[model samples]
Target: MEATQQGADVFFVLMGAILVFAMHAGFAFLEVGTVRHKNQVNALVKIIVDFAISTLAYFFVGYSVAYGVDFLVSAAVLDGSAEGSPFAKQGFDLVKFFFLLTFAAAIPAIISGGIAERAKFWSQAMATAVIVGLIYPFYEGIVWGGNFGLQDWLSESYGAAFNDFAGSIVVHAVGGWIALGAVVLLGQRKGRYTSDGRVVGVPPSSIPWLALGSWLLCVGWFGFNVMSAQSVEGVSGLVAMNSLLAMVGGILVALIVGKNDPGFIHNGALAGLVAVCAGSNVMHPIGSLLVGGAAGAIFVIFFNLCQNRWRIDDVLGVWPLHGLCGLWGGIACGIFGQEALGGLGGVAFMSQLIGSLAGAAYALAGGFAVYGALKLLVGIRLTPEEEAQGADLSIHKIGANPESEMAPR
Candidate 1:
């Protein structure tokens, strides 16, 4: 029975790892569909390459920073059974590392969208290494790994630890906030803003591709949230139900608020899914619905604000979709996850607010610091001529649609 249980848990998380791995494709296609035709190939290449780099960074360094476990021992000693402990079972720790690595890789994926059009390929690659290896895992250690005893301090002071069941603040918020710094430092894409203050809209190239990206992300998110249970016995139907309700709520509200624009409709689904991630295990379905609805509306409102009013030039509106919605999810966990508000309780409003605010501040600082250093040391953006040519031809020497490149004029 003991061996059987260990095997089952291994299979469960391994499958979750595969599912989350598929979400990287979702990230790639979403950026592919959003950026112009000339830059689509770069979008696809960036996500896959960043995933590889993140794997190296996390396996060698980031995982230890977060969890204090190293894969430096031999294969036999690395197995949990060698130590007479469950953690040594079937090399489950290795598979668990695979699962968590997917999340770590998402930081660069989120930033990729924000600085899509003009970011230097090598500079962003260096940024990915620093972020996955240092900036992101530092916080992951605090919240999930018990590194600094921050959770202990929060629990003692407020009667509850920061209750992020699936990392609304940790993964999504951190990624988005970091991207904001990179975007500001990179500045607007060429011709995105006129000197006289006229705003030019750079619309998505392929809605079908964009919709496909949204669909893949929605499907994979089930694993992202539910498999966070990490064990079959720990799994809850509540998490699944809450994720569903929130996704639909985001879609419906975005459809209404965005006036039936397909871009808003698809991204709205992402908004809700993003928002409900933190409280999915604890909130009632209705509460999840409200949270999702608010997230959907927030994405639409703030996406416009960032692009038009603020002229921030976030390519996929990542700061709004992931950063802002992730913030709302963090705070909403305290509100809707409470017993008084029809939730499972054991959450404090003040605790949630404090943790959420700290996450934003920490991410903002990390973002500016990392990108700022890169800006001074190696430069972070493509030159204006390279930007005019698009990243595909300039960086990769290929186009997403090669047939057009080969066609006679």
Candidate 2:
């Protein structure tokens, strides 16, 4: 039974890992569809390479920082070969690392959208290594790994521990806030803002691609949330239901608030999924719906606010979509997860509030520290000449469809 359980758990998590890993394609396509034709190649390259760099960083350093577990020991110990036979024990820890690595990798993926046009490729990759290996896992350790008694303190003081079933604040919020720092440093994409103060619109290159990306993410999210249970026995149908309701709510609200803009509609679905990540296991499906609706609306409102009002020029509005919605998800868990509000009810408003704030705060500091250091040391942005040339030709030496362009026009 022990051997069976261990192998079963490995299979379950490995499936989840594969599903969530596929979401990286969702990230790539979403960015490809959002950025202009001139920069499409950069978008595709960044997501894949960032994932690669994130894997290396997470495997070597980030996992240890977060969980205090190192694979430096003999393979027998790492694979639990001593417990049962090698096959029976399974390489479960390796697959668990794969699953968590996808989540950590998303921090750079989120930032990639915000700094799409202007960031230097190698600079960002270096930043990715630092973030995945160090900055992000530090907080991951605190919240999920229980490194410094933060969860214990929250539980003792407020009658509940801070709860994030997945990576709302841990992954999404941190990614968003960190993107804010990078975006602010990188500044607006050239010609994105005119000297006289009018906002210049740089429209999406491909709506069809964008829609496809959204669909991929929506499908993969079932694994992202439900498989967060990590064991078949721990899985809950409520999580699947809540994710569906939240996504539905996000789509509807975005359709209404965004005046049927396909961009908003696709992103609205993401908003809902982001918001539902924290509380999907505990919140009632109805509460999840409201949370999703709120997140969709928040994405539309703050995306506009960041671009037009704040002049942040976050290309894909990642800060609002992932950052703000993530923070909301964290706090909303406290609100909607209470028995009074129809959640399973071992959560506290104070703990959630504080935990959410702390996560965002730490992210901002880490972002500024990492990106700021890089800015001073190596420069994070493309030169104006490079920016005007577009990242495709400037960085990658080719456009996305060079053959057709070269042959005809």
Candidate 3:
């Protein structure tokens, strides 16, 4: 029975890892559909390559920083058969690492959307290494790994440890806020705004591709939320239901608020999912719906504000979709997870508020520190000529549709 239970847990986490890993493709295609045709290939390449670099960084350093576990031991020891091994039986620990690695890799995937058109490829690659290896894990350790006693402090002072059932603040909010710094530092994409400050729309390249990406993420998010339990016995149907309700709520609200704009509609779904991630396990379905609706509205409002009013030129509106909505989710979890709100209580509002804000501030600083140094030392943006030519030809030396590009002019 013990061996059987261990194997089941291993299989469960491995499947979750595979599901979350597939979300990287969703990230790629989402960016591909949003950026212009000239830069679509770069968007795809960046996500995949960033994942590769994130894997190396996390495997070597980030995981240890977060969890204080290292894979420096032999394979046999890692498999947990060796005497005195800390690893769980049937290699559950290894699969857990795989699951968590997928989450770690999402930081760059989130940032890729914000800096899509203007970021230098190699500089972004270096940024990915530093972020996944150090910046992200430092906070991750504090919240999830209990590295700095912040969780204990929160629990003692506020009546609960900061609760993020998934990673509303840890992954999405942090990634989004960090992207804000990079976007601000890189400045607007050339021609995105005129000298007089009028907004020039750069429309999406493909709506079908964008919708497909949203669909893929929606499907995979079941695993992202449910499998966060990390054990079959710990799984809850409440999580699955909350995720579904929130996704639909986001879509409906986005459709209404965005006036049926397909881009807003698709991204609205993402906003809801991002917000509900923190409270899915505890919130009532109605609370999740309200949370999702609020997230959709937040995304539409802030996305426009960032682009037109603020003139930030965050290409995919990542700072709004992930950052602001994620912050709301972290705070909302505290409200909607309380028994007074028809939730499974044990969460503290102040803890969630402070923890979420702390995450945002840390990521913002890290972004400026990493991207700022790179800008000073090596530069993080493409030259104006490179920007006009698009990242595909400028960085990769090829177009996404090469045959079409080669057709007789």
Candidate 4:
């Protein structure tokens, strides 16, 4: 029975890992559909390459920083068969690493959307290494890994440890806020705004592709939320239901608030998912719906403000979709997870508020520190000529539809 259960847990986490890993494709396609035709290829390439780099960084350093576990031992020891091994039997630990690595890789995937069309490829790649290896994991360790006793402190003072069932703040918020720094540093995409500050619209390259990406993410998020339990016995059907309701709520609200804009509609679904991630396990389905609705509204409002009013030029509106909505999710977990609100309870509003804010601040500072140093030392933006050429051709030397651009055969 022991061996059987161990194998089952390993398989469960491995499947979850595979599902979350597939969301990287969702990330890629979403960016591809959002950016102009001239930069679509770069969108696809950056997500995959960043995932690769994230894996290396996390495997070598980030994981240890977060969890204090290292894979420096032999394969046999890592498999947990060796005597005195701390790892779980049947290689469950290995699969758990794979699962968590998907979450870690999402930081760059989230940032990729915000900085699209204008960031220097190599500089952003280096940024990915530093973020996944150090900046992200430091906070991840404090909250999830209990590295700095912040969780204990929160629990003692506020009556619960900061609860992020699926990384609303840790992954989405941090990635979003960090992207803010990058976008600010890189400045507006050339021609995105006139000298007089009038907004110039950059329409999406493909709506179908954007919708497909949203669909993929919606499907995979079941695993991202449910499998966060990490064990079959720990899984809850409520999580699945909450995720569905939240997604529906987001779509409906976005459709209404965005006035049927397909881009807003597709991205609204993402905002809801991002917000509900923290409380999916504990909130009533109805509460989850409200949370999702709020997130959709937040995304639409802030996205417009960031782009048009503020002239930030965050290409995909990532800071709004992920950052602000994610912070809301973290705080919402405290509210909607309370028994007074028809939730499972054991969460504190104060703790959630502080923890979420801390994560955002840390990520923002780290973003400026990393991207700022890179800007000073090596530059993080493309030259004006390169920006005008677009990243697909400027960085990759090819367009997404190369054959279409070809002369007569």
After the best TM-score superposition of candidate 2, give how far the Cα of residue 19 lies from its true spot, in angstroms.
Answer: 0.7
Clash pairs for candidate 4: none
- Is candidate 2 or 4 superior in TM-score? 4
The digit string of per-residue lDDT tens for model 4 on 311-387 reads 89998999999999999999999999999999999999999999999999999999999999999999999999998
- Model 2, TM vs. native: 0.98
- Looking at model 3, residue 378 earns an lDDT score of 99
Write one digit per residue (lDDT tens) for candidate 3, span 1-409: 8888888889999999999999999999999999999999999999999999999999999999999999999988899999989988779999999999999999999999999999999999999999999999999999999987999999999999999999999999999999999999999999988988688999999999988888888888889999999998898999999999999999999999999999999999999999999999999999999999999999999999999899998999999999999999999999999999999999999999999999999999998999999999999999999999999999999999888889697
The total number of steric clashes, by the backbone 3 Å criterion, in model 4 comes to: 0
lDDT of each: 0.93, 0.94, 0.95, 0.94
Tens-place lDDT per residue, model 2, 73-122, is 67787777766533235888788888999899989999999999889999
Cα misplacement distance, residue 318 of candidate 4 (Å): 0.6
Give the distance in Å from residue 389's predicted Cα in candidate 4 to where it truly belongs. 1.3
Off by over 4 Å in 4: none
Cα deviation of 233, candidate 1, in Å: 0.7
Model 3 residue 251 distance off true place after TM-score fit, in angstroms: 0.5
Over 4 Å off, model 2: 83-88, 407-409
